[model samples]
Target: MRILLTGAGGQLGRTLIDRLPTEWDIHPFTSGELNITHYPSVKHRFLNLRPDVVINAAAYTAVDKAESEPEHAIAVNAEGPALLAEAANQTGARLIHVSTDYVFDGNKSTPWVEGDTPSPINVYGLSKFAGEVRLINTLPDALIVRSSWVFSEYGQNFVRTMLDIGLQRRQLSVIEDQIGNPTYAGDLADFLIFLAQKPQVKGVLHFAGNETISWFGFAQAIFQAATAICPAYASMQLTPISSEQWPSPAKRPRNSVLCSLRLAELGFPSSDWRARLSEVVPQLLAANVLKKAN
Candidate 1:
């Protein structure tokens, strides 16, 4: 199968490239190589490659910064997908897009399901939801996989941030009110590949970590895993605080946990983030050690 992948520099995109079957012909493009929002560029690339499947991992992911830069966010998150969907429809290519769980307003106590209508509260969420709507409207058969709190050793994420801060600081403050699943990008990448092979599965699907946790709780788990690899992290102290205590430009949903029952029914269950955490922390610390040695 010939696959066209966007956001090759990102955590999920990098993971997907590493994990995808080597036998298949893959064309990976970073934002610099192929700007999805540019109409002529997208059209030219799609017509040239004629890929069987197009996986879109490109997105404007700065949740807080999006408040001040709504235009930029919309351009990348909303317009980019629409352009990609248009190209995919024109070229008869299947599009698999990655989205966030922040689309909901966090009012619902239960986990957010595929059928639930999205009422985004912030600029970032609004942009992402718009992207989803545009993609579906342009290409009705496209697959949209929504995940949450993604982290991996490769990217700038909670796990790496916590490890970096824990190395220097003795005490750390984390938001405890917000709750959601922490998805490992590597696992999400694997699942995306699994979905890619199955063309019949089109529409919105939620795939996240099996465990529901707050940022504070996630930090605790990160440190717990980190302490085994780097003993310095054992001395770090974490304090949980409400969202209001740490003021930000953008308002976030208190509960954005996704329901993966539908995905589980499809034979691919949600991954255990704790296991992934255990694996990634060591890789991060080992890389740090190597960096120091170099």
Candidate 2:
């Protein structure tokens, strides 16, 4: 299979590259190499590569920073996907785009399903929702998988942030009101690769981790996992606080948990994030130790 993957430097992209079949022909490009917002460049690459599948992992994911830089966020998260969808349509290639759970306003008490209408409360969420809309309009058959709270050993994420701060600070306050699934990039990558081969699966699908918890709860879990791997994290104290207590530039959904009912029907259930977390914490600690040694 010929695959063209964008956002090669990102956590999900890196995981995808690592997990994808070694026998397949893969063309990976970082944002610096191929700017998806630029139509001519995207078209040129699509024409040259003519990949059977195009996995678009590129996105502007800075939720808080997006309030001040809506244009930049829209260009990458919204326009980029549209351009990629157009190119994929022209080349007759299947486009599998990764999206976020933030697309929902978190107003629903129940899990947000694919059929639910998105009413993004923040600029980042709005941009991602716009991307989903444009991609659908451009290529009706394109698959848009929406996940949440993604983290991995490679990139800057909530897990890494907590671990880094835990090592330095004795106490940390986290938001308790907001609830969502914490997806592992490796698991999301595996699902994406599986979907790439299943051409029949198209449109918006929610593929997040099976477990759902608030930021504060997630922080506790992170610390728990870290303490087992690194004894230094045992001293860290985590306090649960409301969203209003933790001031941020962007407003997040209080209930952005996604429902993966469709995914379950497909026979591939949602990933166990706690299991992945156990594996990831050790890798992160080992890397940190190695970094210090250097």
Candidate 3:
């Protein structure tokens, strides 16, 4: 099948590219090659490629910067999906648009269902929520995957950040107040490919790690695991501090856990996040993030 994959350079996009079989005619386009924020340029690609599937992984993902750059965020996150939706509608291409758990405020103790009413607390969340709304509004048949704390061995993410700090300093402080699941981008990429093959997987579905924990706990686990997995990283101490101790320009959800009984119902296997994390840390270390070179 001919497929058009946007944001071919980001962490998630890179993982998707890695998972795709070389035999498939996949047109991976970075922003310089095709910027989704520009409607005309986006339409041109769709018209030219005439893909059977369009996987949108492009996004303005800077949570703090999004506060000052709401227009750019909306243009890229909201309007970008709408433009793609229009293109998909015009060419009869199925869209697999990625979304976020931030669409709903982190208030629910239980996992968020597909039908939950979104109440975004931050500008990034608000913009992403609008993107989901716009995508559904434009193409009702499009598949929207809401996920959280996406990380991979290859990308700039929390896992790499922790590995870097642990390598640099003997001691490190991480936030303990915030809670969410950390999904490995590789697992999510594989699931997206699986979902694309399942005709019943259309519409709003969620994919996340099996367990949820606070950022502090997550960091502590990472430090402990890194030590076991990468002996070079074993001696460092990871400290947990409250959110009030560490302030940020934007506030995130106190809870960002997303429930996916819906995912099992859709025939996707649930993954234990710890096992996934265990698998990814070694890869990250091998990639030299543990050395903190760049």
Q: Work out the TM-score per prediction.
A: 0.98, 0.98, 0.95
Better structure of 1 and 2 per lDDT: 1
What residue pairs are clashing in model 2? none
Candidate 2 on 177-240: residue-level lDDT in tens? Answer: 9999999999999999999989999888888888889999999999999989777788888788
Where does model 1 exceed 4 Å of error?
none
Compute the lDDT of residue 69 as modeled in candidate 2.
98
Model 3 / residue 18 / CA error / Å: 0.9
Worst lDDT 10-window in candidate 3? 285-294
User: How accurate locally is residue 170 in candidate 1, as Cα lDDT from 0 to 100?
Assistant: 97
What order do you get sorting by lDDT, best first? 1, 2, 3
Model 3 Cα lDDT, one tens digit per residue, 1-294: 888999999998999999987888999999889899888888889999999889999999999999998999999999999999999999899999999988888787777888898999888999999999999999999999999998887768998898878767887788887888888898899888887676556788888888888888888778777989767677777678888888887888888888775776666765577888888888877777535566
